[model samples]
Target chain A: MAQKNKLQFIILGLLNQQPLTGYDLTKAFDTEIGEFWQAQHSQIYPQLKRLEEQGYITHEITISGEKLEKKLYHITAIGQTLLGSWISDGTPDLTATKDEFILKLYFIQTNRDPRLKAMVQEQLQLHTDKLTHLQQRLATVFPTKASQTANYGHYLILQHALGREDYYVNWLNQTLSALPKR
Target chain B: MAQKNKLQFIILGLLNQQPLTGYDLTKAFDTEIGEFWQAQHSQIYPQLKRLEEQGYITHEITISGEKLEKKLYHITAIGQTLLGSWISDGTPDLTATKDEFILKLYFIQTNRDPRLKAMVQEQLQLHTDKLTHLQQRLATVFPTKASQTANYGHYLILQHALGREDYYVNWLNQTLSALPKR
Candidate 1:
C-alpha cells in the first residue's frame, strides 16, 4: 500500500490524541496546528473518511440534541503504530519553502508599480496579525513553560513562529522604506 | 481561464532576463533560485512545453555543433505582461509554511527513539551547509553591497535565508540538547 500523505497522518495524529468528530478535528487544526499546518474543512472530511475506510481509524455515529448526528472518530491501534513510525522516521526535508510571498518579495524590487508600497504595507499587517494570534495562543496554551514537558515541541514552535514573524515584519519595514520615492 | 501557477511565472521571469535552454533554466534555478525556489528538470521541461503551448513563451531550436541542437526559450510580450501583473498583484498569503522539518520537529517530542539526536544533528549540518552556500553566493555575486542595487531583492532574500537557517540551527541544537539522555 502507498504511504499516506501528511494530511492523513496529521488527522491520524489528532485522533490519536482524543476522539473527535470531523467538526472538532477541523477546529483543533485551526487552533492547535494552525501555526505550522493548516487544512480546509473540505480537505479534512474526505481524509477522515479515507482513514476510516483504510482501517487506520474508526468512527461511531451518534445522535445528540434532536437530529444532530455526529461521527466521532478515534485512532485505531494500527493508526497509533503508523503515527509512531512516522514520528520516529529520521528524515525531514528542510530545503523546500513553497511560499508565494517570498517569491513575490524576491521579484518586487523589479516591479516599478506604485501599488507595491501598499502591498508591502498589507503584508506587514498580515504578519503583525499572525504574530499577535501566535502570542495569544502561546499565552493561553502554556501559561508557564515549566509544565510544558510533554508539549515541549509545541512550545518551541510557538517561540519559533514569534521569531519568524518578527523577522518578517522588520524585513517588510525595510522593504517599504527602500521603495523608490514617488 | 485558470491563473497560471507560480512556477510558470518564475520561468517567465528568468527568461525575461535572457533566453535559456531547458537545461540552462534548470541550472539557473539550482544555483540562483534554489534557496528560495526549486524545481526539478522533469518539472521544468513540462512547464516549458506548457508555456510554449500557451503562447507565453517561445522556443527556438538552434544548432551549436555537429549533432548538438538546443531549444532556447524566451519570454514573449504576453509573458512579460503576465510577469509584470503577477509582481504588482497585491495579495500574498503568508500563513503557509510547507517545511517538512517543522512538521517533523513538531511531533518529535513524542518520539522516544534514541535516533532523534542523530536526526537533529543531521538537520544542523544541513542548515550549516545551506548557510555556507548562501554566504558564498552572496560574496561572489554581490562583491560589495553598494554595487547590488540591481539585485537588492536578491540581497535581502539572502539575508532572510541566512537568518532563517541560523534560527533553524539554533533550534536544532536546543532540540538536540533537550533530547532525553540516552
Candidate 2:
C-alpha cells in the first residue's frame, strides 16, 4: 500500500484497548484520533471485513429488533498476534502526502474574491480551536497516569499540532493584510 | 474535488515564476517544495494536461530526436487569475490528516521485535535530517527578497512541515526507548 494499512492497525490498536462496533470505531476516530488520523465509513467498513476474513477479528451480529442491528468486532488471539507483528515490523514512513495550506498558498495569488481571504482566516480559527481541545483532552486522559513516558509522546504530537496551527493563524493574518484590497 | 487540485495550482504557481518543462518542474518541487509538497511525474503530467484543457496553462512540445521529447508549460492569463483566486480564497478546510508516527506508537505495545525498534530509530534520524534542511531553506528563502512577504507565507508552510517532523522525531525517540527491550 502507498500508505501503510495503518487503518487496520488503528482498528486493532483501538480494539486492543476495548471492544467496539464499526459505528463505535468511527466515533472513536473522530473523538480520539480525528486530529492526526482520519477515516471515513467507506474505508473503515471494508477494512473491518478484511480483518474478519483474515481471522484477526471476529464479529458478533446483534439484532436489536427489525429496525436496529450492529456488528461488533472483537480481536482474536491471531488478531493480537498479527497486530503485534505489525507493530514490530511496520516502519511507517514519517512523510506526509499533501497539505491544503501550502496548496492554497500556491494558488492564493490567483483568487479575486475577498471572501477567500476570510475563509483562510476562518480555517485558522478552526484549527486553533481544535488544538485547544486536543490539549485539554490530553490533560484529561493523562492526568496522573503512570505512563509518564507515553504521556510525553502524546504531548509531543499535540504540541506539534498546536505549533502548526499557531503558524497558520499568524500566516493568515499577515497574508490577508498584505494582499492588495479587492 | 475531495482534495483540492493543488498539484495543478502548484504547476501554475511555479510557471508564474517562469515557464518550465515537466522535468524542470519535478526538480523544482523536489528542491523548493519537497519539505511541504511532493509530486511524481505520474501526478504532474496528468495535472499539466488538465491545466491545459482548462485553459489555465499552455504547453509547447519540443522533440530531441528519437525517444526524447519534452513539453514545456507556461501559465495562461486565465491560469494566473485562477491561481490568484485560489490563494485569496485561502484553502479548503485545513483538516490535518493521519500522522504515521502516532499510528505506529499506538501499536508499538503489540510488537516485540528488536528490528521494529531499530526501524523507529531510523525514522527518528530521517525526520531530524529533514527538519534541519527545512530550517536552513527557510533561512535562505525568507526576509531577504523584495518578495519577502510572499516568501514568508511559503516559509510558514515549511515551518509547519519542519515542526511536525521535529515532533515525530521526539515522539519516536521517546516511544522507542520506552519499549520493553527484547
Candidate 3:
C-alpha cells in the first residue's frame, strides 16, 4: 500500500470548512493546524497543485486589496468525501512523539550534568508560558457552553491541547523542585 | 545551518550505556525508547554504518550461539563527548507534535458525527492501556528512591511518560462521557 499524503487531507479539511487562498492555507499550518500536524510552503504548494490536478480541489482567481490576484482554492465534492472517510477512519498507530528535549534529558545519566539545572529551567519557562497561552485561548474561544457546542470538535481540540500543556507544566515544576537549589 | 541526525545521537547514547549487538539495539526501540522516539531497521542499519565511519562507534564480531555471529556495537570516547555536548545544548525548537488523531478530531464539527463515540472510545482504550503499562513500569523500575537513583535520568523519563499518559486517559474519559449515550 502507498503512504497517505497527510498534508493533502489537512488542506482538504481546511478548504472544506471554507475556501482559502494558497496564502491562507500556508498560514493555517503556522497556526491552529500546526498545533497537531505540520506543513511547509514547499510541501503545501506542491500538494495544492497535486490536489487540484487530482480533481479534489479547484481554484479561482480572486482580487485582493488592489487587483492583486490570489488563487482561492475550493474543495470539490470528491475531496469532501475523501476527507469525511479519513476523519471517520481509525488511527492505527499511536506511536510516541519525537520530543528532542526528553531525548536529551535521557542522556543526563546523573543529576550533576552541570547543565541539567539550566536545561530544566528553560523547559519550565517555556511550558509555563504555553500553559498561560492555552488558558487564555480556552477563555476566548469557548467562554460558554453554547460557544463550545458551536464548534464541538475544535473545542475538544483546544481542551486536549490545554490538557497536554497542563501535564508538561506540572512535570516541569516537579522536575525543578527535585533539582538542587541554585 | 544543518539539521541534526537525531537517530545517530540516540544510537550513540545506547552504545554508551553498554556494548550491544545490532539486534539488541533494534530491540531497545521496540521496548523502552519506543515510548518517545522511533527508528526502523532500514534507517537504523545505514545510520550505524555512518556512525562507524565517523569514528563515533565501532563494532566487534561476537558469537551469540554455537555458530551465530553478531556485531557488538560500542561508543568511542569521541562519541561520548558528542553525546555529552548534545545533552547539554539548549533545545531551541518546541514545535507542536504531528498528532494525526488530533488533526482528525478537528474536522469532527459536531458530536453527532455517528463515528464520534466509537472514535473516542478507541482512543480511550489505547490510552488507558498505556497508562496501565506506564504505571506498572514505574512500580517495577523505581520501587524506591535508591533504585531510581541508579538511573536517575531514566527514572525521570519514565515519570514524564506516566504524566503524559495520565493526561490522555483523563481527557479521553471526559470525551467519552460527553458523547451522546447510545
> Top model by TM-score, which number?
3
Per-residue CA lDDT of model 1 for A55-151, tens digit only, reads 9999989999999999999899998998888877766466566666666666644435566678779889998888888888778877874646667
- Candidate 2 per-residue lDDT, tens place, A30-56, comes to 776676788888889999999999998
Which is the winner by DockQ between candidate 1 and candidate 2? 1
Which stretches in model 3 have alpha-carbon errors above 4 Å? A1-3, A65-67, A180-182, B180-182
Task: Give the TM-score comparing model 2 with the true structure, all chains together.
Answer: 0.79
Model 1 DockQ vs. reference: 0.47
lDDT of 3 by residue, A38-134 (tens): 7678888888999999999999998889989999999999999999899888887785788889988887777756788888889988888878988
lDDT of each: 0.77, 0.70, 0.86
TM-score of candidate 3 to 2 decimals: 0.94
By DockQ rank, best first, the candidates go: 3, 1, 2
**lDDT tens digits by residue: candidate 3, B1-182:** 34578988899999999998777778889977888888777788888999999999999998867989899899999999998888878887786777788888888888777888888888888888888999999999789988777777888999999999889988988898888766
| Candidate 2, residue A136: lDDT | 79
lDDT of 3 at A14: 93
Task: Find the 10 residues in a row with the least total lDDT in model 3 chain B.
Answer: B1-10
lDDT of 2 by residue, B20-90 (tens): 99889889777777656778888888888888898999988888888677887889999989877766664
